[model samples]
Structure formats: C-alpha cells, structure tokens
Target chain A: MAEIVGAYFTSHVPSIGGAIHRGLKQDPYWKPFFDGFPPVHEWLAKVKPDVAVVFSNDHGLNFFLDKMPTFAVGAAPEYANADEGWGLPLYKTFKGHPELSWHIIEGLVEEEFDPVTCQSMLVDHAISIPFELAYPDAEQWPIKLVPIGINTVQHPLPSAKRCLALGRSVHKALASWKGDERIVVIGTGGLSHQLDGERAGFMNAEYDRFCLDNLVSDPDALTKDSIHEIVRLAGTQGVEVLNWIAARGALGPGAREIHRNYHLPISNTAAATVLYEPA
Target chain B: MPSELEPIPGTTLFDGEAARKGYALNALCFSFNEKVNRDAFLADEAAYLARFNLTPEQHEAIAKRDVLGMIAAGGNIYYLAKLAGIFGLNVQDVGSMQTGVSVDKFKAMLLAQGRGESYEVAHKEMLNG
Candidate 1:
C-alpha cells in the first residue's frame, strides 16, 4: 500500500516567479524572499516524496467565472503551464498521476466531497511559482503531480472546515492506494495579504504568525473562525489560508511542523512556507 | 436582486448575478492574458473594448480605468489585475481606488490596521453616511 509521507505548504506568489525568471534573486528587494527557499530545497532532498498533491486556486487560467469548480482535480496524464498575461516564463508540462487521481476523486465522492475532475487544465502562477521555488534546477519537476484546484477567486468559497474535511478524504484515498509511493500534500497561498480594493497591499505579520502557530498546534480551533472573519482579519486574498488548513487535514492531525519560513511584502504578498511530517 | 444571503456591507460579492452582469467585461479582461491582446488593448483602447460587446457601464468603467467601478460592474480582481498592469498599476493602486484613499495612505493603512477595521468601521461609516 502507498504510504503517506508528509505535507508541504508554501506561497506561490507570482512576483517570486518573476524574480527567479528575471534572475533577480540577488536583488535587494527580492533577496530575502529568495533566501528563504534553501531550507525547503534541503528538506526536499532529504525526504524526496515521489508524488506531490498540490492544492491551489486558479487565477482565471482554466476556469473563469463561467464555471468555477469549488474543488477541481487534474486527472490528466500531463498538465501544461501557461503565461498568465504578465510574461511569466512557462515551465515544461508537469507529469500527472492519473491512477492515483482517479482513485482519490472516487474516494472523495464516496466521502461526500464532490470534486470536478479535469483531464486537461492549464496551471497558472499559483502552481508554477512554487514549483520553480522548490526545484529551481530541474527542467521538469522531479516528482509526479496531482493538481487540485480550489476556488478562492469567487465568493461562496468552501469553508475552512469543509476544506479540512476534503483534506481528510484525500488522506483516506491515498491510504487505499495499493502501490508503493511516498506522497506530499501541499496547500499553497496566504500569509494574510490582500491584492485588491482600497485595502490592497495588506499584510498582517501578527495574524500570519497566529495562523502558523495554530495551523501547527491547533488547526481545528483555527477552523472555527468563519470565512467572513477570516476575510475581515486576513484580507480577501488571505482567505487562501483555507488551502493551508486543507493541507493540514490531509496529514490527518498530529503531524509535527518540521520547517517554516515567513517573509513579507514579496510583491504585495505575505509569503510563507511550512513542512509537516507525520509524528 | 441581491443574494438572499444578506450581503456583507463592504463587499461586492462575486456571486452568480455579478458573474452574469460582468461576463463580457471579464471575458474581455481575460483576453489580456495573452501579450498580443494586452498590446491590442493598449494600442487602441476603444477598439479593444468594442470587440467584447460590453455594456455601456462596463465600457465606462474600463474607459475611466476605475478599479472600484469595474468591481461594482462585476470585474474579478484577478482579471482586472491584468488590465491594471497595462497602466503600470499594481494591486495597491487598485486597492487605494477601492478604499477611496491615496496610494500612500492605503499602504499606511495596511501597515497600521490591515483590513481588521475595514468591514466593521469603514463599512459602517459608508453605510451610515
């Protein structure tokens, strides 16, 4: 049976991608943010999970307002990256794990979490930046990917509790996989930064710290807060913390926080990364 | 009609109704994802919007480059960011527009209270005043 190794959480801020693509990692404004990734690289080298189940919100890449799936799973053999109109360089097609994807989708539905399964989806910066940040040297990602899309663009988004439950379902499905595989579930986005309205360029370092501490030690307590409160406190884009909570749920509680890095104002985002290994 | 679910006062919730009203405008903004389209819009702003069959309100919102007006007219922030980027406008600029404050003040507000007070204090002020 496939054994779940751990989960990783990180921000996929597009500016981080721009800095890396433009080779401005050493530039003063971006150097601190870039400096935070080496520990992740070192940790990845150590555990080296064979598969990464990524939770990200699409920024009008594949799904627009036409039909936004609350939860979309990529079951394709491969997923492509695209330029999200800002001239961000595209990465090579990411290989997918269709068998595991299908199993997980089926299990999620059985577990009462209806997922919109996609055989083809163009991934945007939300996934690409983190990929580059983590595996900077690879022409292609070293591990197979299972891209899961969560709707954070449109309102009426799934609650943190629901996202957590969905993560639990993902864990249940992964546990049922009969093949030998080491896996990582990654929830990407949010350290309390807002990107629009009069309140744009918002960051709450204190709130972000509260989130990090609670996410590691007391996630359910964090889950109790409503999205309204989260939006009020964390800012609109900060709602992406729900993705982090989902990643925590996939690990099924009692995972030890192995590594974390939090940095601010990376192109108007409170960037963060956390790694959890099962205790 | 607004959603039966009571509206959050300070928000323009992008629910189904907003999506329907803003479909053409968002589709137009979504086109800006391609470099050619962003160039075309920059080259001839009027002609670019004409291609989308936008409502007069949407055209006005785009014409004035009003981020708040665009949101009120059903523009999603992610799509609007592309449009804003064309003018060298960043998220903070759009945010300042929405908050009805100068960019400097907006940044300062973020540093001070974030959105912790926006919904409760600002919205109440907007609603009452």
Candidate 2:
C-alpha cells in the first residue's frame, strides 16, 4: 500500500515567483516569506517523498469561467506551467503519476464526489510557486505529481465542508492504492489578504492566527464558517484557505504540526507555510 | 431553495451574476496570457478591447484605469489582474488606485495589518459611513 508521508500548506503568491527570478530571496522585503521554506526543505530531504498530490486553485490560466470544474484532477503524464498574463516567468514542467491519479479519480467517484479529470492540465502559480519554494534548486523535479484544482476564482465555489470531504476521500483512495510510493499532499494559497473591491489591501492577522491554530488543532471548526463569512473575516482572495483545510483533511485526525511560519504582505497576501505529519 | 447571500461591504462576490456580466471583459483580459495578444492589446487598447465586445461600462472603466469602476462593471479581480499587469500595476498599485492612497501607503497599511494593527475596523467603518 502507498504510504502517506505528510502534508504541506503554503501561500502561492505570484510575486514570489518574480522575487525568485530576480534573486531577491535574501532581500528584506522577501526574506521572511522565503525563510519559511528551509525547514520544510530539510524535512523533505529526510522523508524523500516519491510522489506529491497538490491541491490548489487555478487563476484563469487553465480554466476560464466558460467551463470551470468545481474540482478537477490531472491524470496526464506531465503538467506544464504557462504564462499567467502577469510577468511571472514560466516554470519547469512536472511529471505526473497517471496511475495513482486514475486510482484516486475512481475512488473519488466511488465515494460519491464528482471531479473533472483532465488528461492535460496547465498548472498556474498556485502549484508552481509552492513547488519552487519547496524545492528551490531542483534541476528536474524528483517526484511525480498529481495536481488537483479546486475552484476559487468563481463564486458558488465548493463549500469548505465539501472540500474537506474531498480531501478525506482522497486519503482513503491513497491508502487503498496498491503502490509503495511515499506520497506527500500539499495545499497551497492564503493566510488572509484580499485583492479587488474597496477592501483590496485587507489582511486579517487575527483571523489568520485563529486559522493557523485551528488548522492543526481543529480543522472542522474552521469549516463551520460560511464562505461569505470566510470572505468577510479572511478577505476575498483569502478564502484560498479552503485549499489548506482540504489538505489538512487528507492528513486525517491527529496530524501533528511539524513546523509553521507566517509572514505578511507577500504581494498583497498574508503568506504562511505549515508542515504536518500524521499520527 | 438556496438562501440569499449577504453582501460583504467593500467586497464583490464573483458569483453567477458578476460572472455573466464580466464574461466578455474577462475574456479580453484572459487573452493577455499570450505575448502576441498582450502586444496587440498594448499596441491598440481600444481595438483590442472592442474585439471582446465588452459593455460600455467595462470599456470606459478600462479606459479610465478605474479599479473600482471596473469592479462595479463586473470585472473579477482574478481576470482584472491580467489587465492591470498590462499597465504595469501590481495589486498594491491597484489597491492604491481603488482606495485613493499612494502605493507606499497602501503597502504600509498591509505591513501594519501583518504587525497586528487593526486597519480592517477603520476601513470597515469608512465603508459603512
């Protein structure tokens, strides 16, 4: 059976990509955000996950509103990063674990969750930035990937409760899969910062601290708030915390927080990173 | 029947209504993902925007570089971001434009929030007033 190694949750602010490209990791503006990744890197060196299952939201790169999926999974042999209209450089293509992806897809259907399965999915900054942060200097990514995209851009998005259930179902699928691959689940985006509207520069540190504490101690509590409430408390784009909540669900109960770092204003985002190991 | 969604002040939920209204405008912004399209749009902004057949409000909003006006015209921020990029405006620049603050002050507000200052309350009060 496949071994679920751990989970990582982080913000995937696009400017981090530019900062990385411009070699500004040590610059004062970016240092704190960049500093959060080293501990995760050290842990990754030790655990050496063979496959990564990423839960992230797309930002109009792959799916436009014309045909948006509530939840989409990638079963392609490879996934590429493309231009996101802003100035972030394109990232390296990621190898996919199609076999595992299919298994999970089948399992999700069996468990009564419908997800659009993509043979070819273009991952945006939400996946690439976190992956780059995790493996800063990998010439070729060491692990195969299974990219799962959740709808965050459009309204009427899947509820926080539904996202949690999806993650739990994925956990069941991973556990049942007949493989020995050590898998790491990653949830990327948000620690509270809104862009758009009169509330554009909103960042809620109090709410973010509440979420960070609850993500480890009581994820379900975080889900109790309605999406509108979440937006009010966390900011509009800050609702990307749904990704983190879902990823936490995959880790199951008693997933200990190995490390966490929270920093503010990483390109209009309250950036954060948390690593979790299952009990 | 689904219950009505309460409005969040200073926030526009990109729900179905906005999505429908913003489709043409957003599609135009989405086209910016390609370098050819971006260059074309940059070379002739009016012509490029017209190609999408955006609503008059959207067209005017883009012409005026009005972030708030664009939102009121149903421009989703995610897509509007691509449009902002063409103007070399990052989120802070957009925020500053929307809130009538300088970019530095906008950034400072964010830093203050991160450092545990409560601008959200003040901003909310301003919005309510």
Candidate 3:
C-alpha cells in the first residue's frame, strides 16, 4: 500500500515554462520574476518522489459551459494534452489508477466530498504546465500521478474551507490505502491574480503572503474565508488557491514546511509554491 | 453586458457569473425562443440533456432555475425556455404568474396566441380581479 511521503503546493502560471526553459526570464518584464527562484531545473532534479496526486482546475476543455463537475479525478492509465482552443501542446497522456482512483472517490464521498471519477481525461495548463516544471523530461517522470481536477472556472465554486476539508479527508484515505509506494500530493493554482472583466489583471501580494503563511503554520484560518470572499479578495484566478487547500489538507493539521518562495514579475501577478512533510 | 450585471437574484448554489454566461450561451446555442423547437425539446426533454456536452455545473444551474414555482433566476435562457416549453408554457406563462395568472389557463392562452409567435404572446390566464 502507498503512503503519502509529502505534499506540494504550487502556482501553475503558463509563463513559468517560458522563463525556466526558453529563458523567457531574460525578457525585461519576465526576468525579475524568474530571478526569485533558485534554478527550478536544479530543484526538481533533487526533490524527486514516486507518484503525485495533482490538483488543478479545467479551462474550457473536456468540460464546457453546459456542465462542470465540482471535483473530478482521472483513473486512466494516462491522460492526454488539452487543446483549450489556444493550441495547447500535445503531450503524452498521464497514467491513472482506477482501483485507487475509485477507492479515493469512495473514500472522499464517504468523507462528504462528492468527487467524480473518470476513466479517461485530458488535462489543461493548470496541471500540464506544472507537470513540465516538476518532470522536465516527460518520459522519465519520477512520479506516477493521480490527477484531481477542480471546477474553478464555473462559479459558486467550492469554498476554500470545503476544499481544505477535502484535502484532510484525502489524507485520511492515504493512511487507509495499505499501499507500499510513497506518495506525493500536489495542489496547483494561484497566489493572487484574476483573469476576467474590468478586474482582469488584479494582484495582491500582501494577501498572497498572508495566505502562504497560514497555509503552512495555521491552515485552520484558511477555512474561514468563503470562496466568494476569496475570489473577491484575490481576484478570479486567486480562487485557484483552493487547490492548495488539498495539499495542506493532506498533512492533517501537522506538517513541516520544506520549501517556500514567492515572486511577481511579467504577468503582473504573484506566484508561490510550498512544500510540506507530515509530522 | 449581462456578464457585468449582478447575479440572478436568489441563485445561491452556483457561480452567478458563469450562470449568467450560461444563459446567453443557451440562447445562442439552442434558441428555445422559437415555439416549435421549444415544444419539441420540452416534449422529449429526458433524451435532450443527454445529447449535449453539458457540464455538471451547468446541469445543476439549470436544475435550480427550472424547478417548479421557482422564478427563472438564472442566465441560461435557452434551457430555461426549453424547460418552460416542457411544462407546455412560455415566458408569458412565467410573467403572467408574476402578475397573478394561473398556469393551466396560461397554457391555454399560449396555445391560442397564434402559432409559433412566442414574443407576441401574453397571459390570458391572469387571475380574476
């Protein structure tokens, strides 16, 4: 049976790929942002894990305006790339675990989170971009993945509290799994940014820092904010932070912070990622 | 700019903006404003929702908006209208009820309001003063 070795929380901004790989960090506006991190390539090479349970929200692919699941997990042998109408890259599909995925689905449901399971699914930048950062060489990814997708685009989204609660439940599940392999759960999204309407390019670093602080030290406080208020405070994209709630939740109120960093540059937004280990 | 407007009043479960976007999207896609198609859709409704690529969120939004006696407090007009057709009614039936019209008679008046002319229809089912 697999046990969760640790959890990862990250920002899945599309621009990071440009900075880390192509040296988009050289661009005047993009340079300062990438400067904060100490060589992402070097970092990923070190903190390798066996499998990752990735959390992300879809951006108009697979699911559409007609129907969107609140939380959906894929149990396929692998998931393919998302087109997203923006000509997304066509990458190798992610491998999934139906038995484990169903077990998670049932456990989450029993814990009061209605997570849906899919046999096959495609992932968007929210998941794919981060995967690239962690697994620069796709074929040699150290971690097999349990991709948990959320509905951040459609509104009245799950409250940050509820998302956090779901994470806690997932942690309980890992303990019960009885698997032998070590697991790493990852949550991906924002640290304060919006991508719509008059408030389109909104950013609030102070709030981002506060959020990161609470995420590692005192996550219970995060449960206080409603999804609406969070969205209002952080901006539309900021709500994606709810994804991180899962990473925090997996630690079950007692985890040590492994690494943390924050930056704001070209996209005119704040981004951060935190690593945690169970107590 | 309905997207910019306030949420559909009393829509508590789903995202108001997406709900609103969904309404306009519904109108654009299905155009339930036409009587014949509306009737046809509502006529075999169960088989209908199954055909499209409606997300669970959109399906929930439609469910909340289309429940009986509830006001169409949502943005997706096309599905809402299709729902009205399922009940053998229209926006007039909805509006007339607001003005104290009976649903049964609202059905009758709508049928008599000339074939396929949805925009012009009014509720003769108004309650007796």
Highest-lDDT candidate? 2
Q: lDDT, candidate 3, residue B127?
A: 32
TM-scores for all predictions: 0.90, 0.97, 0.68
For the candidates in turn, chain A alone yields TM-scores of: 0.97, 0.98, 0.90
Pick the winner on TM-score between candidates 1 and 2: 2
Q: i-RMS, every candidate?
A: 3.2, 1.0, 17.5
lDDT for model 2, please: 0.89
| lDDT of candidate 2 over A70-175, digit per residue (tens) | 9999999999999888888889999999999999999999999999999999999999988899999999898999999999888888889999999999998998
CAPRI tier of model 3: incorrect
lDDT of 2 by residue, B8-92 (tens): 8788899899989988988988899998999998898778777887898988888898988888887889998998998888988
- Model 3 CA deviation exceeding 4 Å by range: A18-21, A25-28, A31-47, A266-268, B1-129
Superposed by TM-score, candidate 3 places the C-alpha of residue A81 at a distance from the truth, in angstroms, of: 0.8
Worst ten in a row by lDDT for model 2 chain B: B120-129
Specify the CAPRI tier of model 2: medium
Native contacts kept, each candidate: 0.42, 0.81, 0.08
- Sort the candidates on lDDT, descending order: 2, 1, 3
Off by over 4 Å in 2: B121-129
- For A120-182, candidate 1 gives per-residue lDDT tens digits of 988888887788888999977899989888898887788888988998888888878898888
**Root-mean-square deviation of every model:** 3.8, 1.9, 15.5
